[model samples]
Target: MVSDPVQQPHVPVLLRPILANVAPVTGTWIDGTFGAGGYTRGLLDAGATRVVGIDQDPLAIEMAQPWAGQYGDRLTIVQDNFANLDTVAGENCPEGVDGIVLDLGVSSMQLDLAERGFSFLRDGPLDMRMSQSGPSAADLVNTLEEGPLADILYLYGEERASRRIARAIARERAVEPITTTLRLAKIIEGCLPRAKPGQSHPATRSFQALRIAVNDEYGALAEGLMAAERALKPGGILAVVSFHSIEDRMVKRFFQLRAGGTGNANRYAPQLEEESPAFTQKTRKGIGPDDEELEINPRSRSARLRIGYRTDAPADDIDRAALGMPGAGDRKGRKG
Candidate 1:
């Protein structure tokens, strides 16, 4: 039997634009993130014959059971990361999938649960593992070198005071292990001036950095986009919704490269041969939530949706360096 959490409701961000852009949703579709079953349910309701729901979090898969059974065989929940989504879809669909939708970053469901420790607002264990296993935020905080820690803050969170925060963390952990969200938040808060009105908390960037490192989110996103390229059938649609600037930039570049929109970075640099375009840009620009959506869910404010349609050409490997993926050199010690 399915255990539905009625108390925890999640409204999928930018559902309208996704549906409108990829009109006539039919055949099999994969909801790569599958948080709270919002997109999966949306696809099924919109006319998809079958929807395969994939999520790294066991809790997300488990929470889906309640309404999932109603869809019966139409919805298949997989306990895996979307980076391997091609293999999962191949095993289940066999004919390939018609559409793939990825909603990146921490889910609303996870953020609300204090025990999950995704939010700095409430105190909880500093374990932000989406899979609920492996090395956690606490592990990185209490053990990672100040250099790598600072790099993660700077590159992943775009934190300007990364070095200072890392130094503070190094000093704090010497006195006591950073074990909870509140403790880490307090340490980060100490590194910066108090927030002015309408400003985000001082710990916001550090927490975002730690969460990205703990989950290897950027790595997953890079691989997952390529996996989508491999899994999508010709004419299939790939839609991604990102919550922050870094994520949005990655998605924009992926589509640009795949669609042959990117040219030489420097005019003097010899032009490199271009590969066959693998995707056609479906949305010329990133789509944002309308005011109605913002009025309904303010969390959608930062969300941006970008989409592309697969071409008949075979999928090729994308150079990570070209995609602006944050690297070890992003650390202060390494040379470019």
Candidate 2:
């Protein structure tokens, strides 16, 4: 049986910086990626009047029920993706939210549960669906063409030997379907060299690539950022904690463009008209975990936090290309 995510111990990453930057949290807030209820609880404890916790995973909502009642009406749980946060907030809060917090990527709870199939360390079915629906990692591994599979590994995971690993997967799956975590890990391991001390596992990149593809994480993130802009009230705080370089890059660029910081980096490019900035950047650069957080949770090493405050200007459409979102064409094995 799957365990309760809320009951499980999870330290919210960059909680200190988030709270400090978005200080005096008084109005209703929305925890967009309400995994394990860590950020929601933290916000409530930090003096928020109310918090709407949103999660795509049913398990998170189910787990939250046992503890959510303690706050009575102050805490509301919604079953939906953050990409639809604006709609969810309108239906639940209606007045618009004063703050929004998004902690991106898979949660520690999902990774710890073997049956959830997010981790390669413990063997389980190769299912990496965040919403617990749609095509699973097993399906992608067993069915996708070698070229596409290679593309996912290369573009999503930044694996240098993606072609080699993809060839190995194709060769193995033809004999029998790759259906389990250990089975897939073993295949990837065979393609890569043994890891040195302190190095990540051989299957790390392949597993990450498969998980991102299975969940359409990048697509969700791009849409969710825009959704947050629409959902937040003027002067509202938007705090986002991202893990890994790809995620950080997207968040950084999103804030930059929304704050009217974007322009042609090339000196020869023609000057462009400036639009009203939507948000004011709170942090000039991404904030990483402090030493105390690092000591408490080593996984926070790759974490980065970026924050912005919504301006009175109306929300504007963002050029997805400007946000550094990896193109779908990249997944189709197209060379730019």
Candidate 3:
């Protein structure tokens, strides 16, 4: 999940649009990125017979254990990546899921807890692994070559000063391994200008970039989207809430391609041949939070929702490059 700029308040972004799109929700559904269980609870309350909540984070599943019993069999919690959602959906509902929601927003629980290292606002250990397993941000920062490190920041984080940040990190780590979050934030800050009034913190983009690299979020999202296409029955709805530009672009393109529409970013460039139209889109454009939702949840400012309905066409593989995934499975730091 590429996190939102601000910590979520447990309000699922653009949920109203989802519920309205699939009003009187019924049958089985999957909350692919079950963070705080906000989308799960919403679907349950809105009338879904069962919501199979899937998350790779152990902490998220553990936290849900206390109240999950109330829903009993109506709520099934699975600790796994959404990329494997098709397998889970098959086990839970042999027929097919009625709906699948992939809210790619990071949980506030992870952000508020400084120990998770997702936020640069509070000092903590330099660990941003969502599953809390595998190489950490510290491992990448302290060990990755400067060129690769700069690439992560530039491509994944979209930071223009990635090389400068990489040089600073190399210099600082040579003195001592950068183990803490604040220390890394300080290193990034020194390379970029300080935040001006309404602008985001200097370290925000770098931190997001590092987190994306550590978790392989872009790869997972690309896989998960195809997985959703395969798992959904004809007429099943797939709704995605993306927080950043790259992710939003990805969702938009996926829908366009699957719906037999143009997926090209550059309209002036030659357009690729349309596909078999595996899905029909809810709207041609992505839906953002309305004024009312924005008033209640300012953290949702960057959130965008795109919904698509599955068709009878068989699911097919898509080029990660077509999805605009960073590295395009070509990054030296992490291979897809």
Candidate 4:
């Protein structure tokens, strides 16, 4: 049986910065990721009149049953991806929302459960589907071609040993299906050097790549940013917290592009037309965990928070390439 996530306490990362930057949080707010109900609860406590919590994982919605009723009508929980947050907002907050909070990447609650297979340390089934349906990590490891698999590890995870790892996976899977977390982790460990003190696990990159592929996380994030633009009222706030460099890059590029900062870095290059800024940011460099947060939650070291306030400018179409998504401009993507 799977262990209950509630058994392990979850500490929301950068919650203080989000509340501070988007101060006096009011009106309807949407917690796009809604993992562990941390942001949702925080928003409500911080003065939001109403909060909509959205999550792709059914287990998340199911697990909230015990505490969800405490908020009464002030909190609404929905089962869906944040990419469709605008659609969900249309039905819930037709007038648009005052704020939206997105905590990207896998949640700690999900990682703690051995059955979720998000962590190699736990040694669970090789299933890493955030939505708990469709293709899983095992499916890709077993069936995907070495080239595509390598692309996923290299591009998505930024794993330099991608080719070597893929070759090992291919060889090991041929002998027997890579059906468990430890078995696949062993394969990746064989390819990469053992970690030094305080370094991440050898299988970290491979697991991250597989999870992203299985959940279509990058595609969802690209769409979700656009949806937030359309769904926010003028002066509304959108706060995003991202983990890892790839996710931070995408968020940084999205904020820069939407704020009309997208331009040729070359001083001599011809200037491209800039769109009317849809959002404005106070922190151009983004915010990270302070010393206090670091002392309390060591996992937050990689987390970065970016804030954007919506303007009255009309929502516009954004090319996926503009956001620096892994498989975007190069047109090289991983697929089964």
Q: Cα miss at 120, model 1 (Å)?
A: 0.4
Question: Ten-residue segment with the worst summed lDDT in candidate 3?
Answer: 327-336
Comparing 1 with 4 on TM-score, the higher-scoring candidate is 4
Q: 1-336, model 3: which lDDT tens digit per residue? A: 323334435777888889998887999999999988999999999999999999999888887877899998899999999999999988887757999999884677888778888889888889998999999999999999998898898888788787788989999999999999999998888887778999999999999999989999889999999999999999899999999999998898888888997746543335577768999975788899999999998888999989998999989877777776765233444322
lDDT of 4 by residue, 84-107 (tens): 999999999965799999999999
Question: Model 1, stretches more than 4 Å misplaced?
Answer: 1-8, 264-272, 331-336
Against the unseen true structure, what C-alpha lDDT does each candidate score? 0.87, 0.87, 0.86, 0.88
lDDT of 2 by residue, 1-336 (tens): 475332445899999889998888789999999999999999999999999999999888887877999999999999899999989988998767999999999999899888888899988999999899999999999999988888899888978788889999999999999899999999989888899999999999889989999988988898999999998899999999999888889888878877888574233444435778989985569999989999998999999999999998888766666667665455444232
Q: In candidate 3, residue 202 scores what lDDT?
A: 97
Of the two candidates 3 and 4, the one with more favorable TM-score, higher being better, is 4
Any idea what lDDT model 1 has?
0.87
TM-scores vs. true structure, each candidate:
0.94, 0.94, 0.92, 0.94
Name the candidate that leads on TM-score.
Answer: 4
* Error at 309, model 1, angstroms: 0.5
Best candidate (score: lDDT): 4
**Residue-level lDDT tens digits of model 1 in 139-240:** 998899988888888899888888899899999999999999999999888888899998999988888888999899998999999999999999999999
- Stronger candidate by lDDT (3 vs 4): 4
What stretches of model 3 exceed 4 Å from their correct place?
Answer: 1-9, 263-273, 328-336
